[model samples]
Each structure stands twice: as structure tokens, then as C-alpha cells.
Target: MNRTPESLTAALDAAMATLDEAVAGGKARLTPEEIGHITYIGKGIALIDGLPGVRSEELLMLGDGVQGLVFNIDPEQVGVILLGDYGALGAGDLVRRSGEVLAVPVGEDLLGRVVDPLGRPRDSRGEPVCHERLPVERPAAEVMDRAPVTVPLATGIKVIDALIPIGRGQRELILGDRQTGKSAIAIDTIVNQRGKDVVCIYCAIGQRSSSIARVIEQLQRHGALDYTLVVVAEGDDPPGLQYIAPYAATSMGEFFMEQGRDVLVVYDDLTQHARAYRELSLLLRRPPGREAFPGDIFYLHSRLLERSTHLRPERGGGSLTALPIIETEAQNLSAYIPTNLISITDGQIYLSPQLFQKGLLPPVEVGKSVSRVGGKTQLPAYRAVASDLKLSYAQFEELEIFSRFGTRLDDETRRTLERGRKVRGILKQPQLSPLSPAEQVMVLYAVTQGLFDAVPEPELSQAEAAVVAALGILPDIVRTIEQGETLKPEALEALLAAARKAVSPLLGPEKVADDH
Candidate 1:
């Protein structure tokens, strides 16, 4: 032992091996689990053989930490849907079973972050340090464990809140043609959630990156990003990602809902989600049904949307409201997907191109849009002002349509048309400018009281602005409506007096008195 470099290295190696054997009790030989080799790969899918124990929906490791999900299993082989780059995969590649289902990181830290379906940060920020992981597929709360959807989720859109009030835990479908302000409604709803104690998750499936960027910018500009999480599976991503994006977003929102917090999740558009599912299913060789879609297409959405619910008090009393958007071709509601979602959701808000083209903005077709749960969840103040609005508007529309055909109109009909025009004006809200409860009440009360009847159509906007300003003079009216949830007769009288005072200068005293 002359202590040469070679001799010292040999001695050190021997000593280290002896220490490891001693620490391991001579049982240091570790046996690896069974591994499968890919036999075929294409179309974001692969077939693996040699792993007999792989289960459906189980995670598979395909080298370099890349993973896939076991989509189909057979005695001979298992079909896997690649969640990462498939171009790098080749035949004979070893894929190991992870023995776990796919999950996403979830926690409070996920708020204000942009991520993918796998919980990886997409905002160019590093990975989020989340303490908990949740499975993307979880059964919804049971009936007994769920509570009634009585609490209102104010969207701050006058038309929606006044006529189609969405309740907590409700699944309201926002269906319309492309570029018809469907996403606008969802974004505005998220923007309105600021300071409302509601967490928001916006999932973009198969949308353009530019579009997603614009949405992010809008939320940031409005300070809504603080309470929102954005999950994006853009148009260029694999279909598997688009398929899983909504479910992953739902899981993230579920974390908050379980903590007794209210949440709102928007599937920017499920039409693309459905298409992604169809692509995946067809690639997996599944039998096709209507429109070449998989037979389980309905099940795909039902399972995901069912997760949105309100838990009973014993189960934390939290709620998850779902606003799933669907795009139709040429405003055809008879399409298969639209009809499926319509049947699955509590009710739908139908956006009409005809109305949209007329510069009606949101273009929520009153006759076509119905919220089965919203009316019941409306605040008392709103209910009182809006109870007769829909009917009156419907009558006005009918008369207006007839009047358009050169039909004769009586004095009563003319009065009704004037009232309806004011109603429509009051409901036409600007983008990103959601109305407060007080403003809604003031505007609606004015329309109901015929205060704006004398104010011509061209001056409705200005008159409304003046009334809203005057409403500020009486903070008690707004506070009482918010707190007591109802407007007393005395409160209405005072509101009327205030409105007269507010509009006297704007509308001229003679017109104000004549209208009064």
C-alpha cells in the first residue's frame, strides 16, 4: 500500500461499498418494476406491450419524465394517450408504469397563475409551489351532501342579473355563434367577481394564443387576475391537452370549493373540447356515433360539469358555479352538442346574432334565454323590479314586430313600445363596465316607473347617467337594497323623489313633471 492514486481510489471504493452494504444489511440489490416497450406510436397516441399490470387511466412514464395516460387496455397491449411530445417517442422505447392516476397541483398558490392541464406553469414563471395535488377525475358531491342553490352569483350584467340570475352551484350554458360576445359575458363575470369573495378559473381549450393573451391582458387590466386562474390549451397544443384542460381547471377550482369558498369556472368554449375528445377517441379506434363523435360524448361533458355543485353545510357549504360556453353554426340550437349541453345545464343564455348585429352588444335574446335557477336565486330588490320586466318586454317585442309590418298601434301599444325601448336601453351595458346593485335598481326602477318614457331614445343614455349620479345622493337607498334585499314603499317614494330631482335638470322640469 504505497498510497499511489490508483491504490487510494481502489481502497476508497471498497470502503464505500462496505459502508453501503452494512447500512443496507446486505440487501442493497434493488429489483425494478416491469416495464413496457412501445410497439407503435402516432397521432399523439401509442401502443405499449409487456406491462400486464397497467390499469386504465393509470400514468405511464415514457422516459425523461414525459408521461401518458392508459386510455385502453387489452390482454395483448395497452393504448396510451401521450401527454407530451410524441415526436421524440419511437418503437421499442421503454415505458414504465407510474402506478398513479393523472393529477394536477392545486392550492391557494395557483391563484393568479397561468398553467396547463398538468399544472405546469405557462406564464413563463417557474413551477408553482403547491402543497396538494388533486386527481382530475373525481366524483361529484352526492345529493344529500349538496345544498340547494339559493345564493345568487351576481354577474353585474343588468340583463343577465335582472332576467336570468345565475345562482351559486348552477351550471348555466352560454351558447351562441362565434364572436357573438360569449366570452365577453364570461370575462365580464370574472371581472365583476372582484371583491365579491368568489374565485374564478378561466379555461381556454383549442383557442388561439393571441386570443388567450388578450383575455389575460383584459383580466390584468381590470385587476381580476388576482382572484383568477387561467388554464390554457391553445390551438397548437395536442388534442389530449384540449380534452383535459376543462377538467383540470375544475379540479383546481374544487380545491377552493372544498374550503367553503365559492368559485366560478368558465370553459371558454366546450365546442372545441368536444372536438378534441372526438379526435382522441377516433385516434384510439373507438366507435363513432352521431357526427362521427364517440358514443360517450355526452358522458365526457356530464362527468366534468357534474363536479360543479354546492356542498351542504355539513360538507363545508361551498359552491362551484359553472358557465360552459358552446358555439353554434348559424345560430342553430338544434345541433347535437348544443342540444346536449342545453339538456345537461340548469338553463342557457342564448346570444342572438340578429340582436348582436343591431349593436345591441351582449345580445342576450330575452325570449330565447332562460335561467331555471336564476329567478329563484335573485335578490329581493332585483326580483321586485324585474318581476314584470320580461313579460313587458316580450309584449313590446311582439307589438314591435307587428308594428314593423305596418300594423296599426293603439295608445296603449305605443306606451308599451316606449317602455320596452327604455328597458332595452337600460339593459344594454358596456363591455367591462358591470353595473353595481344600486345602479341596476335605480335604472330598473326608473324604467318601471316610466321616468324615462318622456326621455327620447337618443337621450336615454344621458338620462340614465344623470339618474345614476342622483342615486349617489341617496346612499341609504343602495345600502337598504343591498342589506335588506328589498325595496320598501317608502324607499321607492324617496327614490322617485330623488329621481325627479336628478332628472329635472337633465330632462327639463316640464318633461320631468309630465312624465311624473
Candidate 2:
């Protein structure tokens, strides 16, 4: 089967001809790139004097892999937002146009890790092994591609689940002053997604390292870190990094959401984000608006939050829920940043400093806190039990305020006041402790059935705990609620009777009495 020498030479000649043609084709194509120069550099921003073809939002590269985004295009120079170490860059340093937008790495390997705005690992681990890169900014899903938010996003906090529920893709703002347990709600929500198929992203912009460490410890303790990603731009980081942290984190979460998985992203507090933007804007010489913030401050937040939504089934039926936190000074909700966020978000959970000082754990100001979309997404079981709960609580609060004026209350008024006290007590939950839907339903049923009537306010927590334990052991009521069954009058009466029978013994005869 040996081939002739002349035939072999012919085949070799054909292979060489193909190779020469490919090289000629490669040489015919154009490979063009523009280079710029740093005219001036300071404060995490650089002025580029060339790259006339550079477009706004385009990325530029410097020596040693440093990157910058074209922020402000000017006649003489383009203001570039530095995304890396700008201290090493100086005037006349060569800068080449990347011809791409700033992007971050996103992948499953990022879970259970802490990273910077650039998607680099901050957990002291080696570099993250991500294969996909997404731009920091992306357009929101079109209206036709989005679905109505009809699914519940459980936070596991009794008060929130019962009253201010959050939907799967809604943007619910957590607004309050410092030490109002804002981050606690976010962390508890993450912990609640333990078995639920929800991916969580926590963006800590301009936060202390100690605070971030504590949050990581909490997640690891509860095993939530297995499905959660933490993006940090510490207080010591450049304002530019802080400004882009939430957006970068959003891109990471968006990656999962596009894969038809639900995602929950918490911007730990946007106050710091706004401040960072303000600093960067001023450094870039943008005009200041109210409170010295840039005029585009509203756009800054709306664009980020708008990225969170429920995709239609045609678009994979996934969702991204945003819990954006904003800090206010002296409880001023009308502040520029708070107001802007409140308008952009679906609703807000306003934590009251007054209630905090009074020893309420979450201190959620029910009067001010509202969930516009959650009402539609609330479980039918919860809706049946808590339909009148908020109204009754409001009435009780008004009556209590009036009673504080030294007026004697009638039996009905006094009864309302006592029930409200018990309700408040039941809602007081410890940080990091999350309740399941069934546990929440059982406790609310007990309250509605007057099971806590005899328990003193000081012992209400003990009563609720007993009720929770009884439900776990009895299993019937929890099973019904977990199955999403409707709790009718007759059915609730039976469940309450069984619950009372099981819980009263745990509360002891001294604390149990006939309310009728």
C-alpha cells in the first residue's frame, strides 16, 4: 500500500498552498487600536488627552493591567474613572483604549466568597476561577419580558412575613438611621434561603472590615454562604470602587437570574454609595445638585434597582429581588437620597429609632413601612390570618396613645390594648433567628384565637416559643399551612383548639386562662 514519491510530493505541495493562502488572508485584515495619554491624574480619576475616538463608558487600559472607564467626554480631555491603582499612574503615561465597557467576572465559583468591585477575591483566597465576564451596567429587562411578581420572597422574620412581605422580584427599601438593624434583616433573609432555591448577593459598599467579617461569620455559621456571594468595597477603598460595587454585585446576581434561577441582592446601604458617587462626581467636576450630590443621583440608583425584576416564562421565568438599604439623618425620609430610593423602590420598611429605644427588636414602623407588591404575593394562609392584624395593631396604637393621656378605657378598648401588647411581643424576634411559614402561621393563629390572652406581656415571648414548639411536635397545623391550604373559620377553630391543648401545658396553668 505504499504511495509513490511523486503523489506524496503533490499532497505536500497542496498543504503548503493552503497555509500560504491563510497567512495572506490574515495579513489582509485590519488590526487598529488607538492610544491615549494621561494629561493629569488625581483622586481616583485621570484626564486623558488623546483617544479621540473613545466613546463614553468605554474602557481604557494602562500599564500593569490597570483599567479606567470613560466617564466625561470633553473637547480637550476625557475624564476616566480609575478602576484600579491610580497612584502609580502619572502625567504622560501611555493609556490605550480597550474599546469595551468595564466588566466583572461572574460564575458559580464566586459563591461563599468575598470579592472586591472588580470581582477579585477579598477573602484572602487565591484568585476566583470565573470564566464569564459581564459588564457592570446593563439594560433592564423590557416590560414585555417581565412578569408580574406573584411569588413570595420569604425573609423569615415574623413581622415581615406576616405584615410587610417581600415579593420574589420586588425592590423593597430598608430605610433607617444607624443601628436600626437594617443589615440584620438582609442577613436573616439570606439565611432563610438555606434550602430555598434562591441565590443571594450582599454588596457592602464603604462598610467596615469588622462589620463585613461579622456578616460572613453569621452566614458561615448558618451555612448560607454555600449559596451566597459577598461583594465588598471597604471604607478604605477608593470612592470609585465604592461607587461601582453595587453595580458589579448586580452583574454577578444577574448572571444567575438569567440562568432561570431566583436571586436576592442586598445593597447593604445606599447612603455610602451616594456619598461615594458624590465624591467621584465632584472630583470629576460634575455639577452638584441638592445636598451637593450630582444631578444624576436619581438615575444612579434607579438604573441599579431597575435591573431587578421577574422575567417572564418566555425569558426563563427567573427573578431578581433587591433589598436596598438607605440611611437617613434624624429620621428624615425626605432627604435627597432616601426620597430618591423610596420613589424608585416598590415600597419601604421604615425602622423607627423610637421603637428601637423602646426595646423592639426590628423596630419596623408599621405606620410608615409598606409593601406595595407583597400584598399580591402574600400566602393565602397568611392573608387569612393577618388580614385584620395590621388594622387592629394600628387601632391599638391610636387607642394606646389616647390612653396615655390618662383617660380610662372601657372593656373593649382595654382588650384591644392588651391584644396589641401581646401582638407586639410575639413579633419581637432575635437577630439571626428565622421562622418558617408554618411556625409563623401557628403563632398568628394562636394570637387571633386569644391563646395569649392570659399570658402577661413579659411572658408573651415564652408563650410564643411554646406555641412554636407545640406546632413542631403536633405537625398537623404546620403541615396544613406549609401545603398552602386556606385556613377557614371552622378549620382554624379546630387547629386552634388542638394548638391550645398542646401549648397551654407548656405555658403552665398559672399563665393559662379562659379568655371567653
Candidate 3:
């Protein structure tokens, strides 16, 4: 027999297989493990000197079960950002690769539970019952896989729904100075999602414990906890945890979105998220740019926000709507981070500190805020009621500013100012009390139709409440409006009649008859 190389190689393989089988019953197989040692330790990061094959963003285990992320891979040393307590870790500590990237538990079980960025239960409840895990970083859906945003995500805030509307799958930025009701809008939006079949995830990054508790309590009190998930990375958490919090929350929401469910993920102020990243990047020796932020700062948010979109019917027909909040300083929208976010989002809802001081609960500056896609998604009834509303409101604002100089005005301008005041009054809603679409339309219709012009400005809230209460009697009209249909002439008349009857006592017969 001619001993060919192929036959010889096959014989050698067979001998090795027989030897392995012979020892399988009595001996265990040994596998190679790559271990590195921390060469230096910083506040929330460590430098490792081994693990030549370690991948960037891969999870690493350090002393005492502390986890770290491979933030930078260098020829001589690797930079790892510690995700947990680093006090127990020091130089020369052993580090082991997890052989996987950073991931968090995701499933239906996570809903209604308060958890940290790592998906560990933070509530009194036991461990989360999730059966699957997903990586914290995911590529966004391709354009071909996304559908046009056609459905409205009604926030139930009259000003938002009437002027600065939000559409499902749209990335709408909520930006304002501190204490300007930025988070309030997001929370109210979540509260409004109740019974709308929309799953909400609120990611609190670098917020105070008391603030987080307050938010959770609000959700519970409103029964929104049943459909909402809270992901918290408190202000004192490690910078690494804060940096990854929103991404982890987004992954959790993506799980539900893939299941054909509409999901809303609110990043409560990414300013801290950016600051956390800046800290980590500076520690990792990455070069900083304007505002001392890493050059990839814009890319960081663009990538995360790009993941939110409406998937095609074939892909799931689900949508992931993002309401990422950003905090500004001294009402400066031109700041570095604010500008980046404003350019990235489909539109922005600018909350004015000035308006907030004036006791506007939402403080949404309509002139500065806009909705690029929501107009197409708004209901036909809303279109009819607010077609000229925004323009008229803008005009009133400019005129009011001029009138502040004590200039004498004509009857027409005075009437416009009065109507505008009524409009503003009707838009002022109390916190935690979100209106339904039907109720919003009713009150908005009354204001836009000049029915509220005669009503006393001091009694606007009471009159608006009366109109909302009267909606119960016009169930057919309510149903029609909620169904997104164009309001019929008779339905409009019926709504007008109900509004007059509801506010007659407050307005008096003469005031109510003035409308005719």
C-alpha cells in the first residue's frame, strides 16, 4: 500500500480520537483560560497587562466578583471600566474574561419591576424571573426594515397633543433647565400610556435616590407600574454603570418591541449619561474635544437613538418611541450637548424656565418646540381644531411681548390677547392628571372655537374641568374623536351645546349667550 499523506493524517486523527474516548470515562478534559492582572486601578477603571485576545466592551471579572468592561484595547495594556465596587480591587488583582459582552436580563418578567442597569431587582420583590439576556449594545434597525411613523403617541397633555405632538417611533427631545418640569412631562406621558397597550421603560441615570423613589411612587399610585419598567443608576453609582444605564434600558425595551409591542423608553436626562461617559473616557486617556467631552459624543447618542424606530409589518409592526430628556443651563439651547441632541431628534419640546416660573406646569415653549412627524399622525379631529391654533398662538405671544411696554392696543388686538390668554389657561394642566384624547379634543375645541373667550380667566380651570366632565354625556362624540375620525357637523354642534351647558353656571346666561 502506498502510504499517502491523507491516509496517514486520517490514521493519526483516529488514534487521537481513540485515546480521548478511552480517557473520557475516568478523566476530565482541560481547556485553556486566559487570565490577566490589573496593573493599575483608578476611581472606576483598571489597567490590565494580559489577555492579549480580549475584545473591546467584553465583560471581565475582577476580585470579589466585581465586573468591568474593556473600554480600551492597547498593545501593552487594556483599559477596563469597573461596573461595580472597585474598593475591593487593586493592582495585581486577577482578571478573567466573561467570554461575552455586557448584557442584561430581558423578558416579560421585567415589566413592573424596579431594577438597576444590570437588571438586578432593586425593589422588595425577589430576583427577576427573566429567562433570556440581551447585550447592552445593539445595531439599529436598517432603513429598509423601518416603517414610516403614522400612529400618534398621545401624551394626553393638551399643549403637547395640540401643538407639539409626538408620533410613535419618533425621537422627541425634551430639554429644559433644572426644575423646569422636563421629567414631569416624561412621567405624565408614561402615566398616559395606561390602557393604551404601550409598554414604558423609564431609565433614571445619575438621579438622586429620593427622586427615583418619587417617580416609582408616582407610577405605583397611578397604577402605571403594571405596564412600566424602571431602570435606575443613581447619582452615586459607578460612572461605568451610569454610562451603560440607558443602553441597558434600551435593550430591555427592544425585547418587547421585537415581540410586536409598542414600547416607550424615556432617558431621564442624558446629560448625566454624557458626563459619566466623559469621566470614563478621561480616565481611559481618551482625547477630549469641545466642552471636555470625547470626540465621539455625538456618535454615542446618535447610535443609541437610531435604535428607536417603527419596524415594518413583516419585521413585527412594533415601534420603539424615545423621549430622551436633556438638561440645559440658564435656558441655553445652544449649549454643546443640547445642540447635539436637538439636531439628532426628530423634534424638540423646549421647556422654558421663564414659563415654568410663571406657573406653567409643563412650561413647554411652543414657539421653540416642534414636531416634524406628529402632524401627520394626529387625529383628524385634532387637525380640524388646531389647524390655525399654533399660528394664532405664536401671533399672540409676539403681540403680548409688545404689549408689555404698556402700549395702547386696538379692540381687535385686545380681543386676540384675551383669546390667547384663554388658550394658555386651558393648556395649563395639573401634574399627574393626564387627560384622555376625547377630553383633550373637547376642551381644545371649546377654546379654539372662542367659547372660552367670555368665561372668566380665573374660572378657566373649572370651566375646562366641566367640559371634560360633560364628555361623559357625549359618549358617541367621544368615541368618534377617539376613533380618529373627522368630527361631523352635528357632532361639533353637539359638543358645543354640551360645553355651553357645562359652563353656563360659571359663565352666567349672558356670557354663554354672547357666543351666539
Using lDDT as the measure, the top candidate is 3
Locate the minimum summed-lDDT window of 10 residues in model 1: 507-516
Question: Pairing residues by index, what is the TM-score of model 1?
Answer: 0.94
Residue 102, candidate 1: Cα error in Å is 0.4
The TM-score measured for candidate 2 stands at 0.93
Q: List RMSD in Å for every model shown.
A: 3.5, 4.2, 6.7
- Clash count of each predicted structure: 1, 0, 0
Task: Determine the C-alpha RMSD for candidate 3 after optimal superposition of all C-alphas.
Answer: 6.7
Task: Give the higher-lDDT candidate: 1 or 3.
Answer: 3
Give the alpha carbon lDDT tens digit for every residue of 25-99 in model 1: 966688779898999987878889888888889999986666898988977888888888777878999999888
lDDT of 1 at 32: 74
TM-score of 3: 0.94
The digit string of per-residue lDDT tens for model 2 on 102-166 reads: 89999999998899999888888899899999999999999999999988999999889999999
